[model samples]
Target chain A: MIEFRMPSLGADMEAGTLREWKVKPGDTVERGDIIADVETMKGIIEIEVFDAGVVEQLLVKEDEKVPVGTVMALIRPAGETAAPKPAERHVYETFKSIVNVKEEIPPVPAPAHEGLRASPLARRIAAENHLDLTTVQGSGEGGAITREDVEKAIAERDIRLKPRPAEPAPTPAASTENIRMAVAAAMSKSNREIPHYYLETSIDMSKALAWLAGANRQRPVAKRLLPVVLLIKATAKALREFPDLNAVWENGLQRKAEINIGFVISLRTGGLIVPAIRNADKKSPDDLMETLTDLIPRARALKLRSSELSESTITLTSLGDDGADAVFGVIYPPQVAIVGFGGIREQPVAENGLIGVRPVLRATLAGDHRATDGLTGSRFLAALQQLLQQPETL
Target chain B: MTEADIKTTIFQLLKRIAPDTEPSTLGPTDNIRDTLGIDSFDALQFIIALNEKLGIEIPEQDYGKTGTLEQLIAYIKTKER
Candidate 1:
């Protein structure tokens, strides 16, 4: 049997609460099927199973918060037997005990609420209102507290303390605060550890934009390409020439063969998420645009998969239409470099011995000094500029 | 379609693109995209959806002209003729 553990969604994530299970004990699941909805500091993320197998057992209960690498389920391999052997069960039992022993003690006394059962929603409501679960009586199966019971308790309490202004309803700010904290933690760790070096360059977008407008004129609005797709493709192609910039510094510089570009999508509420467009180097500009169009909505909805969150070799942040002239991004570790693109604007340019107006874009790179120096970064930017000038090749 | 029908259709399309938007709260002259916080990608999506549902083709140059609610309604009504 293969152990299915809780995956660390990002470098900042330490634990995630199992919100709901999409599979049962005997369900057959394929790779990339979303098996559970996990609640992390970021938001509710649908967890995808990486291995195709027949699920043997679900070890963790719903609403249980567990740390990274904690085994939550067991799956029998696709070609394996129908059930685990007796010896395997014994080994599983021993492993469970060892894990249980290492768990931290709860803030509440364990004996007080022993054998007490409450619905997940009721438990959440109680915690939000600071109402003790032991005090609220359950009216569910086996006398477990239902959501109504918690609501009734809250109502009664509100009546007892009437004449005061009603308490404000819970807002999305709480979750946004959680996301802000996660971003702060990751960025602080980045600033504290990584030796950052900054580089900036400007590329004229006359040829690229002209080609794009002509290309878009024949297409429908749904299929029309955006300039950001060209930027992503050019960055990916440039990485092919400069291998060191496409590496992560984990103990040593480990260059990744596949180019997974983590494009940053800012949420409407607040904060941002970087979800990867896998194998960006191999995708055409149209394909990249489609992937980006789908990715932005899903990232905003917080419905990203596990691998999309964890498997990015490099990150890209673009300050679209209304942003500043240039942006220098912080490198998200263990990824060694981040590329930033500013808004494209018309500016006076002296090119080919003539001064004229052309659309110009400022591109910036922030690299970890330990993994690469200024020369490699300059070459990468130069290559990126060269690649953009010939948009048809991309 | 009548002007009222166009208004209703536009609001429905807007709601689908940005779920949090409140139609009653928006001023007629206010920029729909700016007030609703719809970015460039979503704006393009909104336009595409409008084209599919209303059978009105909005060109790239005219995208900026349809920013406000009244402007979009008037534009679509003229096209429906």
Candidate 2:
């Protein structure tokens, strides 16, 4: 078995946004055939197969951004198990640690005769109810034990399965909520606590618009100039010079490094998610556009894997014409800064000592004051200003 | 120390680290904010301070659950065990 990893797009790139999967799992492929399209820091790159046989499994799906060395797909010569052998990377557990208890509990050993392969949680539910899992057949995918199986077992019998009268329903024992619920709690806490200082700067967008218009005229309509792509390009340039802005404030420690960027997208059903653009500070405008557009939808669906959500140094939030010129964004905690991109509007502004109407857009940077001072903020904004001014370079 | 002793130690630790916070209102069941009001940023600071004071590491991954005092106590006990 061979593994295909997310190749670094450029020299400075530590990761690439998994933009789109051109091929699905179990697809046959040849060497040099385009397997997936990855949006690298440089541009949207075609992930061509080096050795061809069968794409046994896609370790990553389209729109999931991953680190450079992360295995995105695995290929087998003919037939091989996609399941990463447990020996290679079982959840390494210390005997006891605070972090361990909260993580996914280990899967319990299965009962051989029962033939009811149950996850740890399902087995616990069954044991708690005194329902014989052996009598109940699994209806889940691939004969896996599901909550429904236990429920069915309970229903098929006429016996009352309630716990002893003295136990008192475990009193909603542990008061444990899912991790998603924890995220909600964090959001509410952020809104209530963070004294978010919003600095909105409307940049002259005439150059970007003109440059994009001309660039689009040269390229296909399917790939046109979008503001986000341009913003990525411009922000990348700004972050390159002011890397301090790209930081995380962890337990009295400010982790200042890579200029990864996270952008928000609202889901079709409900709620919002922020999927990050890995190493945006290095990606070209076209590449940034490709990464942002693809990953935003995946993020909204909560389909982004753990890899995608992890390791972002900074983030961006945009309301996209939902409100006025500026959006005061909440800093995605741990991250030092979040930039908000508001809708572009035509406004009169002074450019090169000349007052004129130009397409301008509001860009706000909310930074952790402890990490990035106003001067560093000024440098980032100034660098951004300098980048936007050079539409010719983009 | 027993799990209950560790919980009490944590409750005491919280007060020392977050000087502005008075956790006398805190209980095993009470939410962190309901007991002693803490916003998200404040919560982050509190976690950092708690870890530093205890000389225990609370990785960023665990901070989500450890935000509340009740949860934090549970987390520390799990670690001590």
Candidate 3:
């Protein structure tokens, strides 16, 4: 017997409401059959199966929310004399449905495929409104649909479209207010309650930067390494030695783990987006650079599908504007620490009893005192500057 | 606009938002919010006011430490500058 589990629709989204069930118990289902619909963070998505089998039980009922790995249904071989090989094959098979249902009025009823059947009106309305009927929790007998169900689905769908109304400019305010609310609550608490201490350091990147320029001239367009990438790499490596900065302050206590770095990329329209590069501490500076440059453009455009917006524990904000020498960044919430990168400016400085114009960046570390102290934070920043100073060892 | 002009305008707006507000004795040193108890919800109200008063799209990312009147003025001043 094969257990048909609720599919993982997004990276950070763990569970979803079972909007509806297209197939029922004892229904003969085939490979690629629409088994049930689940409502995830993105929207309603149709759930399908890859193995032809007999439906023995529906573990989750309509309108019930279940975790990503929760079993929603059970499937067995098509024939009475069944084999276990088909079930095994489907277990390892992972495929995602990318159908965007936009026509709210519904389309010609999609054939039930096997024994499943839906009203032509319900199908057409679903296709027109872009509602995935799999998610509609049918109140009718044998899990059939009713007119009220379609209206309810539309009301729920209307929430995302709420900001797109008569006024265009205020809509951005509506959208951005959500983000500000989250940010303000955090900064206020950090400033008002949490004991925070800030430390600043400067990094000299002449040698490593010269190497980057030469390497970029020889590398392909997508393969070039940027300075921000090297900074992330150095920060990650240093985090390994200074585990205290990677800790989180929660429940009046400190919790430590390997930190993921969120790179804050500004969108052209005004908003800023943070995308996390997971387990970056172990990756080389060059590799970190490549990932940062690649992920930033995608994230900034809001092109990230549900799965792309995964979880991250820490972040890095860079003000690499063309002419600016330095910029400060605010910390993202629930994160105990955030590192800022100023524009690498050329300045004269004395080193080893001699002074020369060198490329440098003013780095700032704002940390929560509950998790880290000024000494630990300073040492961490010092180690980070040291790593950026020498890239050949990384 | 001059830096002083921007500061004056922010102060004027902040003054109107908090009528019970005392004459702002603090300058760049004072927290933009502490003088008025401007919590997160107040920040949204301020953004709405700024949008109406300034004809700008003040993104949330551009706001975080916008706690001090100077910081708010700095943000508005920089946007125009």
TM-score of chain A of each: 0.63, 0.54, 0.55
Reference contacts preserved by each model: 0.31, 0.00, 0.00
Ranking according to TM-score, highest score first = 1, 3, 2
- Tens-place lDDT digits, model 3, residues A147-219: 6776688677555324222222224443344334333444554455556677888788887788667776675
Off by over 4 Å in 1: A1-39, A42-62, A66-175
Name the candidate, 1 or 3, with the larger TM-score value. 1
Q: What is model 3's C-alpha RMSD? A: 16.1
Label model 2 with its docking quality class.
Answer: incorrect
Q: After superposition, how far is residue A299 of candidate 2 from its true place, in Å?
A: 2.4
lDDT of 2 by residue, A233-349 (tens): 678667777766776555553655667777666442334556668877677777876775567545533456545665567777665533368887777666667888887788888
Interface RMSD for all numbered candidates? 1.2, 18.8, 16.9
Off by over 4 Å in 3: A1-189, A252-256, A305-310, A321-324, B1-81
Count residue pairs with overlapping backbones in model 3: 25
Of all native A–B interface contacts, model 3 reproduces a fraction of 0.00
Q: What's the TM-score of every candidate structure? A: 0.69, 0.46, 0.47
Interface DockQ of each model = 0.39, 0.01, 0.02
lDDT of 1 by residue, A167-224 (tens): 2332566556666766776677688788999999999999999889988899987898
Candidate 1 whole-model C-alpha lDDT, 0 to 1: 0.78
Task: Report the number of the highest-lDDT candidate.
Answer: 1
Local distance difference test, candidate 3: 0.62
